[model samples]
Target: MAIIRDRDLIKDWNDIPIDLIKSCIQEHQKSIPRLDLLENYYMGKHAILSRSMGSDTGLPNNKLIANHAKYITDIAVGYVAGDPVKYDGKQVDEILEVYKQGDIVSHDAELAKDLSIFGVGRELYFTTSNDSPIPKATAIDPRQIFLVVDDTVEYKSLFGVHYYPKRDLSNAVIGYSVNVYTEKYVIKYNVKDLNGQGYDVADRIPHYFDGVPVVEFWNNEEQQGDFEQQISLIDAYNLLMSDRLNDKEQLVDAILMLKGGISIGDDEEEAGRTIRMLKKYKVLELPADGDASWLIKNLNEADVEVLRNAIREDIHQFAMVPNLTDENFAANASGVAMKYKLLGLEQLAKNKERYFVQGLRERLKLFANVLRVKGRAVDVSDVTITMTRNLPANDLETAQMISTLSGSVSTETLITQLSFVDDPAKEMERLNAEKDVDMKRQQKAFGMPINQDVTVDAE
Candidate 1:
């Protein structure tokens, strides 16, 4: 539980007993592999295809089931980190430019998606070069790494170990080892770094802070996902949809039957004949009297619809992701009314916003440290984040509402709420420039030179 200080010798980190490191990994490995499963489910990669019902007999309809897992998570992430979060402070434009150049919005979206997938998402912040336009943040899947916090406090992570593979020059895999991260140091440790005679401090790279460079985005404080509670529902939903499709096929085609004495080759030949007849011809020839009467089935469309609706309702209910395409929400509604409809989503967004803010602050802190090392030190302590929901609302009405707030609201706040402006700070700059041009034109019209500054009291 001791704090890893900059003055701490490299031996303190490297001299850890082999048994202790093994125990740390042993305790957490069991829980790490499930992350891959959850991520696959989110991507609709395996759950639909892998889980098979015993009665997949005739047709090979391998159509994937309704993948609501991806929808719910995508909507949740779209709301959580939808817009680009800005850093507000003097000389922070350089940092903002860096984020813009790096496409931080897409990077954050990937982070949120992984957060939903693995319950824990991580980003590695590092500078590519001294003259790098912006520091890079690489999103790492939780399967390749584990997040470790102090066993006592449970929230303070002093460091993290990333187990990435070491490949040869020809891109052949050799082995994997842990890369240890702290604020002031990043040390690569292999089996040798752990057991070698003495610590080689020369290999360590110094950084700005004395904490880990990894910023984590947790789906929840307990590190659980939105669909975890109703994860089984996804399987059930897919099974039902697949069964329905299979049933529909059987019901409409009317499985051919030979009631009386009739020869139709073997089962494979019968299947091929049936397929050929269904696709090419509609006529069926019955050899004997009352030989075929069409084995029709009544599958109760109402019951299937009920079951499908129930499963869908349960999924959206438990996931807290409402069906945006619901007919009930088809009407064009006010923002406040729509907000009420999205109350559950709003609640989930609040939780995500809280966690996302914590990670973003850590991100800015790393940026600040890197900038300090470059002699362009910036204070981003007071920088705050605001998340705007990408919801359907009447924009003109909202703009009119903002107009009513004349002196009550700040121009920056108004610009943020305007929806058309992507960056409020930059829009404010544009507005000021336009104002200066207008004043210069007015001064020249009044026989006043445009070179002199205009005073407020001079009017």
Candidate 2:
């Protein structure tokens, strides 16, 4: 969302002007309000909460919130990234060892959630300063950090800016501290002026990664949040539900209408006492021709329920997320039937995977560069990333499919089909090891040495 194209940054390349950096920061500031709104929506702060019930102000104004935004986002994130992404390639174990040390699984999930919430996510990879330095990645708040890309067709990232306001004891913003991440160096700046036009370089530290250490993960090509398109629908649902409750409350406190003739004591205090006595006794003294009834508005329960169901369905449908609690999902659907039920969500996950995998490749490159310096260079190009959708698997069906395709497909591919197998390559190794042990036992039973080949008699 913070992509700005400047020909000058490309022309100068190495010598980036300070004013240009300030302008990019200012450009990023413009998008903060929209980001803040999306974040607030996810946090259950809907427009209905601030709604004004005008005119008849005495009516019950219940601000009920469903928090469907968070629900949909969590569903998408969990469906895509509930399980850790698997890395496969020649010598990928070394890279995975680094991932294990950095706890990439948790960070990956966090990044996916951020993408769902803000439409874009950012991750910063840096090397630890302690002994035995290893590259570590942490998800950065998209609101506080952004990458500056060039005007070329590729839209290559020129640099990254991570800036935050400096606050004093009273939490008053005095100035700003900005960290500009270039390919070679991380330049720190302190802007003391009210306007961000002027700043002084506080420090410059060299980061020996192959590229700028920040990676941007987009939710989609347009970079819109999962529920962004259906936000209005969500708000409408919240309003309808809240007002429905209010209507029920109004029914409970319906006004009493007395027709014909009714009498009370002459004084106003006596009238109040008579009303209290009527409430306490559940009886009203009236003339012979008097009649009483409650003034309640007719409520069509079926219509309200239908409208509520429509809104709920649209929010899930347009968002491409499924209502997991819906009857379609609860009917014990398995395998292909369950996949059909989740087709929309799977499509959404596919787009997310496309971009998420891109960001991960960039992260892998950064780790590869750092590991290269440590005499453990890896060929990142050979590495393939596998994303498994987090879903309930039908183990019997999967086993049958695997058995049918055993010889037709590669063992690694079959192993990957099994949800229980975390690492297909590792599982293959264990399988081979077991086969070797079985072969050795057969040779010993035939009175042959372990290394010697055993020839079985046809007789």
Best by TM-score: 2
Per residue, candidate 1 scores C-alpha lDDT tens digits across 1-459 of: 122223232345433444444545555566766776777777786566875545656653655567788888888887766766656677677677778777888898888888876777888877676565347788987766655555453456656656666678999766556666765677765543333333233346765554667777777877887677667998888888887787778777676677656555568978688768756886666655647666877788899899989999999988889998899875757667777878899899889878878888888878877777777878887776777777655688878988899789898888878777777888999999999899889888997877877555765
- What's the lDDT for all of these models? 0.72, 0.87
- lDDT for 246 in candidate 2 is 90
lDDT of 1: 0.72
In terms of lDDT, the best-performing candidate is 2
Each candidate structure's TM-score, on Cα atoms with residue i matched to residue i, is 0.80, 0.95
Give the Å shift of residue 95 in candidate 1: 2.9
